[model samples]
Target: MGTTRTIKNKHAANGSGIKGSKASKNGPVNDGVIKAKKNAGTRAPIPGSGVKGRPNLADILKKRKKRVYSEKELGLPQLNMVTPVGVQKPRGKKKGKVFVDDRESMATILAIVQAEKDGQIESKMIKARQMEEIREARRAEADKKESERKAKLEETKDSLRKKRKRPRAGGKTQDDDVNGFEAVKALAAEGTKAAKPKKKRVSFAAD
Candidate 1:
């Protein structure tokens, strides 16, 4: 009979089995240094700290300083202009009177103006004559109506005279008719008698 020796594993001999290096005692590594968390517990306040009681607005405005910021400080981009400055625009053409050298056209225009004037004068004269004729006709009509009225009045007067001169029926008797006739005869006889001759008075005065 032979005796055998047993070999023990090396990994089992170590304390841990992880593959990487041992972890650090502190937290994970950061690219920059970490700041410690501030204490939230109450502490004595600073004299210049916390929300300050608002100061007088007028005093603050009066004492405030004005700061002018440059374009570089404000981070504005630079601008480039391409066009030229101060170029004057073209001037417009001015208006001027033009004279014509055509004498025949000018004479024709003058003749046309004179013809218009003559037409206006003729129209005015014709209107005046027509108005005069209308007035004369009205006057003639008035005169004719007046003459007719006078003739009618004269006819009425003649009619009234005839009515007055006409004898009334049953108003005259036969005796009245006879008396009127005898009176007319006596007047005719007196008018027909001749005047007597003057008597001679010379014989009685001689004795």
Candidate 2:
């Protein structure tokens, strides 16, 4: 029993890394922690496995959301399948407005300011045409109003130039003058005429 105990302890029982001895707790090697490491070589790939050591990709795709694919979109290409070959992203392109480094010189800016001060900022023929049109419209409107006023003045002058009214044509003549009693009698007659309806006489002819 003493010799057997020495033989057991001779093989790195204190984790000193001796031969035929396993690593201990907190040792460099953990062979002692594994139980069935003996004859435990790397597992061979499953029969006819497309990807070694991994489950079938077709089974995974079947479990996912099903999608209909065309022959063109699902064709097998004669290129590297797993590793990417070249640039994946597309080339950069301009999106919207771009800035330019070209700037106006001081001489050009000064010339522009001077031209503006001279009231000739730039020869805008369009604006000149528009202003002419506005002037023409205003002139036409003024001419229309002036013609109407002139005709009205001419009509008034023609009316005033006519001969005076005759005294018999219901004017303020001596025949139209009346006393207070006559005026009252005329008003009473007018009131009676307005209040009564005129009767029509019906003549009967007998055979």
Candidate 3:
């Protein structure tokens, strides 16, 4: 039979399992922050310290900035460029006058322009003559109608005059007419002359 002897010993050091070596005062921290650390510093190294060839670990997080550009900074020209308040830029360049070097082409253009002007003038004269002829024809027709109206009026007047001068049926107007005082006296004198002297002549012849 064999008896085995085992002796156990207790350690006095901290048993923390964190990694990496302690760094400078303002160095980056990886194992979360110590709320109570304040401005205080720690000197104890982590249990599983240095990684052979690397420096102390750092966990850095930086914010990304948005890009900005001015009109001058833009690569292409900007049509919507805003002018600064109370400031005016220079005006655009003026256009130069164009000179024609070919005199033959210019002369041809002038001849075409003259032909167009002459055609327009002749057409206007012909239109004016046609309008005048139309007005003259209307006036002559109006004058003819007026002459016919006057002739009709004259015929009506002549017919009325003839109607007034024409004789009617009866012819014995003097005998059946009523006598005035002068006609009665003339008739009585003729009757007295015819009745008195003839009786005395008849008596002498009988004796």
Reference-based TM-score, model 3: 0.35
State which candidate, 2 or 3, has the greater TM-score: 3
Q: What does the lDDT come to for candidate 2?
A: 0.41
lDDT of each: 0.39, 0.41, 0.40
lDDT for 32 in candidate 1 is 11
Candidate scoring better on TM-score of 1 and 2: 1
Q: Cα RMSDs of all predictions?
A: 34.7, 23.7, 28.3
Q: List the residue pairs that clash in candidate 3.
A: none
Backbone clashes in candidate 1 total: 0
**Residue by residue across 1-207, what tens digits does model 2's lDDT show?**
554333333232322322213322334342232111211222322321233333642233222212212321364343435745553443496655765445656667778889886675345766798899999999999999999999999997765433122221343243235334443444455456754311210010000
Please provide TM-scores, in order, for all candidate models, with all chains considered together: 0.33, 0.24, 0.35
What's the lDDT for candidate 1? 0.39
Write one digit per residue (lDDT tens) for candidate 1, span 13-94. Answer: 1111111113322222210111110011123122112333323421221122111122123543234345455453334744
To one decimal, what is the Cα RMSD in angstroms of model 3 from the true structure?
28.3
**What is the lDDT for 69 in model 3?**
18
